[model samples]
Target: MTSFLDEFAQAPNLKYLNHAAVSPWPKRAALAASRFAEQNVLLGARDYPEWMGVEQRLRERLMRLLNAPSTDDIALVKNTSEALSFVAFGLDWQAGDQVIISDEEFPSNRVVWEALQPRGVEVIQVNLKGMDPESALLAACGPRTRLLSISSVQYVSGLRLDIERLGEGLRQRDVLFCVDAIQQLGALPFDAIAAQCDFAMADGHKWLLGPEGLGVFYCRAELREQLKLQEYGWHMLEHMGDYSRIEWQPARSARRFECGSPNMLGTMALEASLSLLEEVGMATVGKLIEERVLWLQEGLERLPGIQLHSPMNPARRAGIITFSLEGHDNQVVFDRLKAEQVVCVQRGGGIRLSPHFYTAPKVIEETLAVLHGLAG
Candidate 1:
């Protein structure tokens, strides 16, 4: 069996447990970037076509990542924000059209929909604090609801939604389904086609272990034409290679979402990173991450004078567990963990710890030991 842990030779003091935020790139990904840099320094643009092949591989990898219907359904964008923006502003909004969203969405998901305010579109913030979160969201939908934009996993609470159920429910009502999958895409088995999702976007920086500037957008093949192109460039043209042609139009595929030059450097890193995921298999990746999460959850529950803020249900989680000590403030605990070489973050009401499949056991043990020391 190929051990994922064998590749990571980090510092003896380092305990990286924050994959939900910015992630540390793997050794192979780092080597890839270094090679790319070396190429740039040694001979710039000498093998540009080879780089384009890498970019195409990136699109193919993303198609596999989101289980998009085809490679034609994938677009390499700058980030998730730009993909969400394409769907937000490109849509022809009516005066009474309503966009449904959860109250716990990250600003990227919330702000884009809210930006449609001047176009007479209303963004509805649905409370997802009930026994059945999917049901709560489905119940909030009314006749005028045009689309439901949601995060597959809540950033703070780490509550994973049943996107398939949500998609089926919304599709029955003819509502568009857009999922911000940054927290769930690389962490779990995210299938956009299985969910019947109209749009899915995720940044590569977090769980994908890729660079910050590039991400993936998956638009359902049918919905590609529905969105009117807002941004245009020579690259997005159908006849991109034919510079002499006067008449041109945007690509009929998901490449229509791309408005500018491609990010080849980002493509190199993300493609190499995704190769690891494909080798391990996302189903196994999800199970291994769940195992780590369960270990942390069980350990956290046993600790005295601690409160678990993230959801307890295994059915509703991906790669995050959150907690707060009884008397300590979030920052104090965060700094203490930081000093101990535990890479975690302060989110929601407390500290958030997110570990990936290869997170060493000692990291969790040391984190609990630190918490135990704090409790005393």
Candidate 2:
């Protein structure tokens, strides 16, 4: 039997630990994209309908990955930021309406809400430093609070939130819950229905191991039309292929959010990447990544002058682990690691390392060995 790790044949000496930012495509995904390009070059639009089948499959796969109620709930968007914009600008915000977010949000989650300030909507940044983060977020939701948009896993600190609890609480309070699931979708088992989220979005490039320009946006069935549509085109029309029709409305399905032609090239890669995930099984994938994170955490804990920034509890984290050296600046440590071909990032006041399920144990060992040399 062929080892699954062979699908990710990276440079022998390169220790890649930055899946949270962008992931290299699996061999299958790369081949899929290449084949797509070849088809485009040779036959052009002759096989376009077949390509649409791939796009449909991509939507179906995303629906399965998100545990969504139906494929009707999934919209193929350009990225997480664009999906967030759909929700931000779509809502009918009153002057006194309040939107609550966390202090540690990536600018995608924070800036969208902040942009609403011109509409007289107040954006509240809640501190998640307390023992009970869910409770703290819930407490911030008052009479005028309209919605709570949060990341399933904090991008910087690698703090995974109790999403089910927060979602249920917001549901009871009649508050809209939106999840920025870019970091969690492929790294952990995610369920939009179980979380009771009104909206959810994730980019395919991160943990999905797809290209950067394509992503999935999930809207609850009931709230689909409640969000005002900002863009329009033939694809988003109710009668999509009926070019001669004089009158038209947006699609009743989640397709309404997709204003223009789909990223067929990106679709080819993402569909192939997701097929790989389905084959591995998300449960198995999550377990492997957790093992890697625990291994990294244990190694870092034993090293001198290493200060952990991410949550220690296994239940409170996903694939990310971050730490800082006691005597070295974060940039200095990050540059040193980069110089050695340890592909990582400087984030959340420290050096952030994110390993996917396919990451080799040798990579983790080599990273620890490098840190050991730095300590000495």
Candidate 3:
């Protein structure tokens, strides 16, 4: 029997610790894409109904992954930005309405709300550097605060917030909550319903172990029709298959967000990738990821002049661990690591290393050894 680790066949000398940015697909995902390409060449859409079944399975998997209410809440989006745009532009905003976000958000999360400035909607940036980041965010909400959009885990610092707590607080305040869950969804166990997020989105290329250009968007069932439709096509219509119908409405489900054709190629790869995650179970996956992150943290802490940037508390961490050498430029350190085939990135004034659940012990050991040499 082959081990689950065997699913990943990375190069012998390549130490890939960049799952936070992009993940190499599992063998199953590759094979699924290959089979899809072969089928396309052999018979052009002859089995398109079977392809649609694969897409449905993908939605079901994503629904389970997010702990969403139902598959009705899941939307297959092009990327995280598109989903964010749907919320940003779809909302009914008024002058003086404000959206609260952290200062450390990725561009997708920040820029979307800022674009609403033209409509007199204010974007408030709260600093998450304080001891109680959740408290800071909650306090920032006032009468004018319309929504609170946050990342489940900070991308650069790997600071995992207590989203359940925030969710409860937002509910009491009657404020809508949106979470950019790209950094946490696959790396940890994410519960959309428990978190009480009105909206959430994440890309498949990162910790999901799939290709880019495809992602999951979850909208609360109650708010399905509340969001105004910004895009329209045959796929998003209520009478989707009835092309002869003169009048139609947007889908009653979250499928309303999906306009035009689905990315069948991406659907094939992501569904197969998600199957591996399901087989492993997210609880086990999250536990193993934590173990790897903690192991990396311990090794980095032992290095001379190492400065840790990610959260030290285990409860406040996800899969990311970032650090910097005391006297080395971040870019220089990143360049050195890149040249050594120790794949990683520089972020938050430090080097960011993200290891997934199946990262080999050898990869971790050798990466530490290389860092030890650099420290010396």
lDDT tens per residue, model 3, 41-67 = 999899999999999999999999999
Query: How accurate locally, in lDDT, is each candidate?
Result: 0.90, 0.95, 0.94
Model 2 misplaced regions, further than 4 Å = none
lDDT of 1: 0.90
Point out where model 3 deviates above 4 Å. Answer: none
Q: Model 2, clash count?
A: 0
- The alpha-carbon lDDT assigned to residue 207 of candidate 2 equals 96
- What lDDT tens digits, residue by residue, belong to model 2 across residues 138-175? 99999999999999999988899989999999999999
Give me the displacement of residue 374 in model 3, in angstroms. Answer: 0.8
Question: Once all C-alphas are superposed, what RMSD does model 2 give against the true structure?
Answer: 0.8
| Better-scoring candidate (TM-score), 1 or 2 | 2
Alpha-carbon RMSD of each model: 1.1, 0.8, 0.9
Give the worst 10-residue stretch by lDDT in candidate 1.
Answer: 1-10
